[model samples]
Target: MFALSGCAQQASSPGADAPSGEEPAMPDNGDCPVIDSRDWKAWVNAMPGPGAETTLIVEGAVDMPTPGYTFSWEAGMADRSAVPAQRLHLTATAPDGMVTQVITTENVRYEGPAIAKEYRAAAVMCGDELLAEITDVVTAE
Candidate 1:
């Protein structure tokens, strides 16, 4: 005889055909898996799928002042020579109501074995007022 529950099986004899001690397995619906914090950069780099035509890449790291907060961003452009200039801006707000901005502008003058580009001065503005501005440039081959 076959019994569904343990108590019901006890009422029957040991000769019952039902298996003992093991329960039926349930189906698993995989929704979201956890990502390790250390692998975050790898995850971000893999966002654009295989079919992306034009690529825009931005990458930077942000340092936290104290206690508990941090921010980082990255981006990339596949065809750097296509556009004369490309502008990017990053804004962040801290828990204490402080605001920060990072701006970058790339200017292409010539194209050879190596590429030269300039990043216009970046501005850190708080609220409606500009706090600090600095000029920096980067080149990539």
Candidate 2:
């Protein structure tokens, strides 16, 4: 299991019996009014399977100032260079209004395909801030 320091939130991945090459749907939070916090801890897990297909799961949690904040995995793009890497983007949004002062956590999850043995690392980013770097990628057999 991939681990992130100071992050207690856990993300679930698609089951092994699920159809191959089917991407999961992102949560609908398009109507949120305010942009939530970027303070987060991120992690990435690589699951290698047959046919040289690798599933990369990026997970993270943001520190919100109040409740009612929702987070989602915006996108994940692979940098195909001499050394490949995956860049996972995240966003946190909340309703417009004043809420009680309670610290909240919003978790995000992204599951996608990656070329097995190709990527050297995966980086999770929120806006311009780098949240986490995962270097222990499981290469193809």
Candidate 3:
């Protein structure tokens, strides 16, 4: 005759939470500056008025200020070496032919792009507080 032993164990309640293991780690992005365009494209819309101001709008913006429309791997993607320093200088000529310049500060950098669900979009103003004019608009991918 053989004898067997049995023991009963308690079960956890339905409300009890399960033990969670370690979470996955984020990929390493080295400190080196990456000046890639992230495959973003751009378009331009300019409405110049005879005596009035121009209207400008941009989309698909790269962060740190990479403004564009949609994504264009050909036109947008760039290696860190290919990334150019940002320039927003605007030059305007008045009716009298006097050339005036809107010196935009070098606020845009090549660190990376500012991508979100909708990309980057904005309406740029070139004039002063009372009257702002937008002559050129750049939208990107």
**Which candidate number maximizes TM-score?**
2
Clashes of each: 9, 0, 21
- RMSD of each candidate relative to the true structure: 20.9, 18.9, 20.5
Decreasing TM-score order of the candidates? 2, 1, 3
lDDT of 3 at 127: 21
Q: What is the Cα-based lDDT of residue 37 in candidate 2?
A: 39
| Tens-digit lDDT track of model 2 for 17-122 | 4577864442334433223434332233344455544566655566666788666665567776865787777666665788886667666677766544456777
The list of candidate 2 runs beyond 4 A from truth reads 1-53, 139-141
Residue pairs in collision within model 1: 56-76, 57-75, 57-76, 57-77, 58-74, 58-75, 58-76, 59-74, 59-75
Residues 46-83 of candidate 1 have per-residue lDDT tens digits of: 23457533332333333323322323222222235432
Per-model TM against the reference: 0.25, 0.53, 0.20
| lDDT of the candidates, in the order given | 0.29, 0.59, 0.26
Ranking by lDDT: 2, 1, 3
> Is candidate 1 or 3 superior in TM-score?
1
Global local distance difference test of model 1? 0.29
Greater lDDT among 2 and 3 belongs to: 2
Instruction: Name the lDDT of candidate 3.
Output: 0.26
What does the lDDT read for residue 58 in candidate 3? 30
Candidate 3 lDDT tens digits, 1-141:
233333445575543444566333322333211122122223333334565332222322222112221221111321233222122222222223333333221222122232221222222212211111122325332
